[model samples]
Target chain A: MTPVGAVATIGRLCRITRVTWLSELLEPGRMVSTAIQVGSQVFLTACLWTALYAHTEVSAGLQEHQAVGYAVLAVLASRLRPLSRDMAPDSFYRHMREGTILYWFLRPLPPHRYHLVRALGDQAHGLLWVLAGYGLCTTAGVVPLPDGRWTLPAFLVSMFLGQVIVYQLSLILDLLCFWTVANSNALHVSHFVQSLLSGAFAPLWFFPGWFTTANSFLPFQSTLHIPLSIYVGRIPVNRVPREVAVQAVWCLLLWLITRTLWKRAESRVAVQGG
Target chain B: MAGGTALRRSVYRLRLSWKLTSLNVRARLEYRVEFALGILAGILWQASVMVFATVLISRFPGLGGWSSGGVLLIASIRLLSHAVYGVLFANVNRLHAIVQEGKLEAFLLRPLPVYRQVVLHQFHINTFGDLAVAVTLFSLALRRLALEWTPFKIVFLCAAVVGGALIEAAVQTALSCAALRSPTATADWTGWLDHTLSTFGNYPLAILPGAVSGLLTFVLPVAFIAYLPAAVLTGTYEGTLVPREIALASPCAGVVLFLAARRLWNWNMRRYEGIGG
Candidate 1:
């Protein structure tokens, strides 16, 4: 895309994000203050992380870089709220099954595009909170801009992909409510599993030999660990393409899974109604 | 004669509570797959502690002159305390929601003390997984250390674990009383405080700065639950005055905190406006 197009895209994204976020802002000052508090809490967590690194005799480099990486990962991990049973997509799917989707179905825009727009809007709201957290960490010196030239670009790409992957996974999990009334347990279990596999609690390197090897081939690493590693420049510049490719593959796979699930879900709804 | 009758009534109530708890476990078991999955999830949660230990140990052979075995002792104590929190006092964490939904008034109308009823209301059987993991880790650390086991040391460890549970329960109860004060604040603050304390409390107090360490030890008394007791058991501090003080005072801290918490809970009861009242 051209620079102008890229700017335009970002502007559109920002507009979507701001509008969604503003919906919750009945009192803008209170919302901003709450956001700041959230940011400060993230800063305190980063401080604790730094202290742990300094005290523990971990390798100096890992202690410094990976500690910050894990700190950011921890902040992000805490933001995931499991979809409660009441909040599950059953009602939405039921509407779709009952042909109420025809309301939107009759609209000029495709249903898939509508869903994408809605999700993007939601994600933009979430991204604002994340930025608040990032700002807090930066202010506290818990996160420093990379002295190395490659750090900025690498971190931006990795974080973007991480967000995409996480959103996709959540969407996939939410889709389960289309078939099952009791998807709460599945939601909780999937989140717990994701946290474990994604190296939110610890680096993937610390995982047991077989699990670590397996995780390397999976998209779970790309969610937090791979991006973090790239942010810290643990993986060299030459290896950037392979890392991005791995993340891209996971994204593609998730997209395919989501497409198949949506189609099957629609068919199930049709059959049940008939 | 009155005291004797009261004692008998207490015993009977305890028995009834135990039966009720067992029934809950059986009810949970009806969903056999979910029960199994919950147990597995609990184990995985426990295993994350070890994974963290592995990472720390791999990076630093020792933390502050204490070896990995010493750290394991602390971690095990923490796990046991957490198990108690999960199994017995887990409902304390839910008190905020109950208060908001006006459910507490139902219990208040009953003859039983609200606190006792609350404690006995729910049981998370998955806590057994944490208990098992903690015991296994403690034993492994003991073997690795090659410390000659004495009856005195075993007694001390048991006292420490019991005391730790009491302290954890007390803190949770104290936080629960916030539900009576500001319903929404209870959820926001208590959850944040619980997570913050539990995660940060796992590491040795020495890892933190002096002020923070003082805050954990005195302000929150989290150090009493895991660090101080583990320090005594592991003999990590040979000649420190702080260690001596902690060894003597940590268990007593639990008793004091529980008494204070009990008082606070009763005070809050009077202020409670039942649902729709």
Candidate 2:
């Protein structure tokens, strides 16, 4: 599967995992009732989106396509967990000092893979709910799919780039846990900044001139706006290659930084007591 | 003697709470770098809203007969309300964490009222950033609109703004009580609600569909925060009640909501079977 497809599949599986656990945790009756209530809430939101879009001048096809892009972005962003201060160098170092990393080390999974799986498990259900809600919105004509024939190809490429950019940026934020104790506020601020800069809360077109000019050159825009613009047919089809090329460069830069940090972190990880 | 002693004790507690809150302010100020950055972040966030409004106005010229300055008045009031909420009731927003960690139990054990303790427990000193932004925006609006500024008009405007803040805090606290009963429901919904109110509240309620306008006016009382007051202030909404009665009464909705929320909180506290206890 392509990375986007993989992320989607993984996301769905994660949702299933959490749902099964939650079902078991709650009494069967309460589980069913809660699920139904949450489901209706999602449905209502979709209906509202649909109602709003119906009155607007935006075409139906564009709405549906845009909804899909939003869905994909939401799911991926939700799944890509940033490192919490509670679980970073201090916690990790303490765990290592207590020989706790040995538990995972002895297992078949590598530490990074283990962390990734754990994040997936933790976020699966929430991501699934978002996806299901997005799907409902799309079906209900709340989300206008793009009209142009080029929307599909452009969206697909732009989404891939968006995912890579977001994942890498999050990975870098997580890496910051290696150096700082109080990064939770930093993470929260970053999320807010990203939402505004990345075009998640609304389209980048809505931003002011100076902000638009500044954000255009940043990798943050690649995370959401690039794909959104593509879906809206605002970006020409010919630009897809160049956009993806920029995303690839970002991914490589982040990867190199992450690798260097991981090496440094490992060296710093002295088993003090053990 | 007993009554006098009891009165003294209550005053002492109030003083203690004030000191604690001030200490939090002091602690936040000590981190000059983080504090400065936080202020900058606040400005940036406010700029986003202003920019959004500017774009909308530039495109449409006017929304539902309201001028840009009028809209800014609404924005300023909304930000002011948010700042008040942030400063006074930060823990109300963090109810999920309080619930999850069994922190609510500690508040229960205290001699003070649960509502007071909960409200006073966490104070986000950073909210001064929002307050600063609101003041700056309001000042700009005053200049742009060039309203006939009589002393009474200024006093009424300030009252309306402060009252709007109180109401917002009350509504937020009341909604937060839901987390006490439904732990699984996302507390982030409060943020979503705030966003929805902030986004739609800046525009004239009349521009929205009648149903939506009615819901905001009656149910959410968001109209009182900005729209109605601005209307009265600008003479767009004509009535004997505009400045004298309605503006004064509008803040009461917040007070009523807060009183009801306090009751709900008390009831929820009795129901709390401490998490992991």
Candidate 3:
């Protein structure tokens, strides 16, 4: 493709994503629901870090200010992931169960492309909420900005790669719905594993050496912890390249995995008739 | 004759509920693999909570002067209360989904009390997973604390468990009632409430701001479910706005909440017009 054409394609995708996001934000009911959901998350993080920092001399290698950044960023970064990002009513399993997945097959577009487009919409919506949350927390003096000057751009790059990795991983879970009769339970288990290992609840620094060592091999850490740690300046600026490289590797591998699974899942799609 | 007839009718309703639950249980058993997978998932999910608590405490040896054992005991009580809630009130917890799908009409037409009907429509054995985790943690906490296990203490513990369960159910029922008015709003509210409990319930109440802590104690009163009970048992009840003596009233608090929630449920029921009646 020509460079101009490729740029145009990306711009169109961004426009579509923005439209979906604005519509959701404009809905009063949805806005209120989103506010409450986001508010509680920010409140929970504030309370947790406040409490943790209160009694402990220091947190998982984080000073008090860095602790607040880590806590706030972790919660927001969690919402930025694709597979589990907020505000989407139709999960892959739910659509498959109702046989509405066949509707996607009828479109001229490839299934992966269709899902990616829809995911962009959901991602935009979640990003808005995350920004709102961060703004609110900062204004309330509950969270602080990153101390390092170079951290902002590096954090953004890592966060972008981390989300790509999440999208691919979520695609794998979405593909499982084709073969498995019940995928909701699988989603539940994965959610627990993801939240625990990704350092959303607590930093990986606090875990036992063996656990953290083993976690280094998994992609979950790259999803939230690596990017978040970067934002809080826990990882040295020199080590940022290596951590980002790890995330990129996971993204490429999972993307290939999902591509293979999608082919198999395509053959298994049998629409039930009324 | 009237009293005897009323007594017989109540017994008959109770029998019907049991029969319905047995049938539901049998149907669940038919999906043996799914049922087994669900139980395993439940256990793993609950275990992850323990892992979080363990990791948190490993960093901070004693949370605000509360011993590690005291923290574990509090966490175990929260899980225990959750187990009881899951087993008994899981169906009621789905009221939002029911309201959304326009299925409430079927239950409203039933002869039995709507709450009883909702509670008995499904029997969840997956709660066993939560129960198992809770009991294991409770036992470990007991050993670490080395408290004397007298008959009176045993009885008090039993009552606390039941009371904690009741308190959780009352909160759940109240949320379900709230769903009847603004289904979507209350649904989100319930989710917020659940998030609040699971996230903050493990830590000492002293960590929260005074206003927020007071809300958890008096308004929502989730503290009575686990924190207060465990604190009373460990004799570490400090920094609470409420007096230490009131901590022992956890069981009584549960009963009061349940009765009050029942009243709220009935009031909401009268106003409910499911998706335009």
Q: Please name the candidate that would achieve the greatest lDDT relative to the true structure.
A: 3
lDDT of 3 by residue, B144-223 (tens): 78777678667767777788888878888988886776665555566666666766676678777788889888887878
Candidate 3 structure quality by residue, lDDT tens digits, A11-55: 876875665666655557656865776776677667766666675
Give the better candidate number (1 or 3) by DockQ: 3
Q: Residue B233 error for model 1, in Å?
A: 1.0
- In the range B1-277, model 1's lDDT, one tens digit per residue, is 9999999998999798999799888877765655776676677667767766776666656554567788778888888878877887878877866666566787888888888777777677568777888888777677667666789778877778778888888988888887775654455556566665566566676766577667777787878887888877777664222658667567788888889998999998877766422
Per-residue CA lDDT of candidate 2, range B1-277, in tens? 9999999998998798999788766876655644565666666666656654554444434445567777787788778777776777766867766776577788778887877777777667457677887888888778778789889777777777777777777777777777786644534456556656666666566555577567778787888887777776787763222354665466566677778877877777788776522
Compared with the real two-chain complex, what DockQ does model 3 have?
Answer: 0.46
Sort by DockQ, best first.
3, 1, 2
TM-score of chain B of 2: 0.85
Interface RMSD of each: 4.8, 6.9, 2.9
Q: Label model 2 with its docking quality class.
A: incorrect
- Report how far residue A167 has shifted in candidate 1, in Å: 1.8
Tell me how many residue pairs clash in candidate 1: 0
lDDT of 1: 0.68
Off by over 4 Å in 1: A1-63, A69-125, A177-180, A183-185, A206-209, A263-274, B1-4, B30-32, B238-243, B275-277
* TM-score of structure candidate 3: 0.90
| Model 1 pairs whose backbones collide | none
**In model 2, what lDDT does residue B57 have?**
49
